[model samples]
Target: MNAIEIINLTKYYGKNRGIIDVSLQVKEKSIFGFIGPNGSGKSTTIRTILNLIHPSSGEAYIFGKNCEKEYNEILKDVGYLPSEVFYYSNMKVIDLLKYSASFYKKNCDDRINYLSKIMNLDLTKKIEDLSFGNKKKVGIVQALLHSPKLLILDEPTSGLDPLIQQNFFNLLKEENKKGMTIFFSSHVLSEVQKICDEVAIIKEGRIIKIEKINNINNNNYKRIKIEVNYKIDDTFFNNIEVTNLIKEKNIYTFMYKGEINSLITKLSKIDIINIWIDEPSLEEIFMHYYDEKM
Candidate 1:
């Protein structure tokens, strides 16, 4: 069963464009990434899927059910963490969580307890007293308390520290392992790279590429770092299909997505002191799409 299906999904705010004919499928029990820069329609698409805002055209489905029409029914099995975290400021964390749990049918006490402990959340603290990061932790715990089958997160690590972010990613991986499908939307390419099984690159409100993680990391993309005997012009390295090229004095770094033979032949012509070519990070590959017209 597919986790989510968005077909020709377009949203417009009055005369302004949100997304245009956007379409994608997130497989069941997989970590799928929806990546783009700010104002690239990530939030618009997500809100449309959740039926928080009706689409201008086309449809969204979750677990084979129409999201707009059946949201009341479908949302029961869905967990969501928005890009921003907000809660009743006066309530204690435990109280807020319990109130949220009331909306679901199942008993989530054990689930909340376990998630809170692992997330290092102090439930006794009042929501008003918590820092931004702590508030985010509460949001995570509340979203997962019901053990929903579908998880939707948008820039979930915004206020979290590096250690907490890693812990959150590991928690998400564990949830995915247990057959919870995830739709993660973010501008942080590194975080998405660490966990997603597949990635869809969105540019100017349209998808430019949807590829498996392995294919993107291993094939058709290489991170090249070169130490040359002399300064190299940016245009000199432009002969090949390179995405992001940077030259700081004698060291040149960039991502290449063409035939290895071509890159090797080009490097052979130059007086190279040392060269290292390896798998390019998703961030490196994303820069190709990011630079397009907004």
Candidate 2:
């Protein structure tokens, strides 16, 4: 079953467009990545699905229930951490956590303590006195304490340090193993590539593409950098399917999308000094989509 399903989901703020005909499905117990540049409708689509904002037209479903009409029941099994987190500044971390727990029927004390230890959050600190990163830690703890079946996170790593981010990712993976579905939205493609099973790329308020991470990695696009004993004419690569060609003294660098054998045959003719070929990263693939006129 799909954990989340959005069908022709369009949202408009008066005359301004929020998202245009966006549709996608996130499989249950999987880590799905919603990625796009800033203002590309990532958050808009997320908010619409959560029923935080009414869609101009479209339907959002969470676990087969209408996200709008059945949100109260659905929310009990959903957890969300917005792009930017805010809380009552006067309360202590533990107090705020307990208050958040009060909304749920289950005791979150053990969950709270476990998450706090993993995130290295100080429960004694006041929300007003904590740094931005610390505040983010508080948000992380609160979101996970309830042990929701579905977790929706937007720009979740904003203020976290590297170590903390690693821990958070690990935590998500652990939860996923236990059947928690995660919807991770962010502009950071590298992290998305690291954890997501599939990704939907949005641009200009539309979903331009959706593909599995493995499919994207094996898409036959290669990033190649070669150094020759002597400077070679740029025309050497003109016959091949290449983009972003760069020449610096005796080295040539570019992206190639074609049969590897053809490239090897061409490379055999060059007096090569060194060569490097690697799969294009998610960020590089993301650029390929955004670079288009659409």
Measured against the true structure, the TM-scores of the candidates, in listed sequence, are: 0.92, 0.96
Tell me how candidate 2 scores on lDDT.
Answer: 0.92
Off by over 4 Å in 2: none
Per-model clash counts, in order, read 0, 0
lDDT of each: 0.89, 0.92
**Ten contiguous residues minimizing lDDT sum, candidate 2:** 285-294
lDDT of 1 by residue, 103-144 (tens): 998888999899999899999999999999999999999989
Error of 2 at 85 (Å): 0.5
Considering only N, C-alpha and C atoms within 3 Å, which residue pairs clash in candidate 1? none
Best by TM-score, which number? 2
